[model samples]
Target: MKIVEERISQHFQLYTNFSMNSPIRLYVRFVFVHDGMNGIISSDKRRRVVNALAKAFSSRFVFNHIDLNDQGLYCPDYFRLLKDSEEERYIKAKTQRDPNVYLHIYSADTFDGAKYRNWSSFPWGLEDDPVMDGVVVDYRNIENEESYHWIIHEVGHWFGLVHTFENGCNPPGDYVDDTEAHSDEIRGCPPEGIHNACPEEKRAPINNYMNYTDCKDTFTLGQIERIFRVAKVYRPKLLEPEVCIPPCPPPM
Candidate 1:
C-alpha cells in the first residue's frame, strides 16, 4: 500500500497547479486481490469486461491503464487490514513513499439475492477523499452481464461520480448540468430520456451510471462532463503519457 501511494504522489506532485477544478486526466493501476475462499471469473472473461467498460471513458476523459500483479497467495498483503475500522488508511499509508497511485480491492461473491449497493457497502467511497479507494462488485451484481458495466460503475465512483438522485433539492446529486435533477434513485429501467428536471429544466439522463433508475445502460453527455471535471481535479497522474497503442482496456 505504501508503495502505491508513494508512486502516485511522486507523479502527481510534478504538476504545480493541481486543485479541485483541474481537468480530468487519469492514470489507473488495477490491483486484483482475490479472496482465497472465493472463485475468480477467468482472466479472459475479466479482460473482456474491463475493455467494454473502458469504452465509456473515450469520449470525455483521458486515462492510462496499468494492471498491478495478482500473485499474492490470497489477496494483496495490504488488503489483510481491510476492516471497517481502517477506513481511509490508504490516504496515510505511503507505498514507496508516494501518495497518488490508488488501490481498490476487487472481490467476487455469489450474493444469492443481494443487490448492488455502495462500492464499500456504504455511501462514502474512502475515508480520506470520500470518492477514492474502496472495494467494488460482488458475484450477484455482474454475474451474467458480460459487459463489465458493474465494474465500470464502481470505477466511475472511484473516478468521482455520485448517485443520480441523492436528495429532494438535487443538491446531493452529482452536480452536472445535463443530468436531470433527480429527487430519488432509479432502481429499474427508466425512459430513454426520463428527465426529472430538478435543479434545472432539462430531461433526466436515465441511462447514466449515476442514476438510480434502472434503464438501458448509457451515459449522458452531461455525465461525461462531470466525470471529466472530477478526474481533472483529483487524479492528474492519470493524465501522464502512455505507450501509443490501440485503445484496449488495461489487462487484469
Candidate 2:
C-alpha cells in the first residue's frame, strides 16, 4: 500500500488545483481480480452495473471497461493490471493534463453493518461524490436480482453523495439543498427526522438508492444533479471523453 500511496501523492502534488473546480468529471476503469474466499464479482454483472452508473451520471464522467480477470495473481501481469486500471491510470493521466482526477480502490467484503474498519476498508465509499476514480463492492449481502441495486448505491457514494444519516448532523450536509440537515445515522428507513415515526415536513427517502434497502430502486434527479456537480469538481479527467448522448439528467 505504501507504493500505491507514494504514487498517488506524487500525482496529487502535480495537480494542485484538484479541489477548486465545482464540478469536475473524472474517468475511470475497473479491474476485478480473484482474491480469496469471497472475491471479485462476475464480469457480466459488473459490466451492466457500470453501465447503469455511466447512465446515472450521464455527461458528468466516463467509465472505460478494461477486462483483466483472465490474468493471474502475483504475476507481473497482475501488478500491471493494478497500474493499468483507472485508479492508477486516471491519476497518472490527470496529473499530466489537469488536477481533478482521484483514484480509489474498491473491493468486496463482509459489511458487518458498519463503516469499513481497517486497511481493507481504507478507501471506503463517500456519501457525496462517492466514486472517486475507482471503487470495489462486495455483492455477498446482495442476493438474486438485488445485486444491481447494491452496486448502484455503493457507486452513488463514489459520486460524492453521503448516507442520508450516519453518526450525527455533520457539516457540508448532503449538498442537496432539499435534503434536511439530519441529526443521526440510520440504517433501515426511519420515519423522516423521527427515528421511529414520520415527521410532517420530511420522511426518510426510503425509496432513495442511498438508503439501506430490501427493495430494488432508482435515484432522484435532484440526487443525480448533485452528484454530477461533485464529479465535475473532483473528477475532471472523466469528463474528457466525447459522449454523443447524455443519459437523462437526474432532476434537481
Q: Which candidate number would show the highest lDDT if scored against the true structure? A: 1
Give the TM-scores of the predictions, in the order they appear.
0.61, 0.54
lDDT of 2 by residue, 84-159 (tens): 2454344333322112343233443434355531111122222242333344444352223445556666667656
Query: Candidates' lDDT values, in order?
Result: 0.47, 0.44
Cα RMSD for predicted model 1: 8.3
After aligning candidate 1 to the native by TM-score, how far in Å is the CA of 49 from where it should be? 2.5
Model 1: per-residue Cα lDDT over 101-189, one tens digit each: 33343443323255543254221223355433544455334445643555666666665665666554545355555656766665666
Tell me how far the alpha carbon of residue 69 in candidate 2 is from the true structure, in angstroms, after superposition: 4.1
Per-residue lDDT for 21 in model 2?
32
lDDT of 2 at 231: 47
lDDT of 2: 0.44
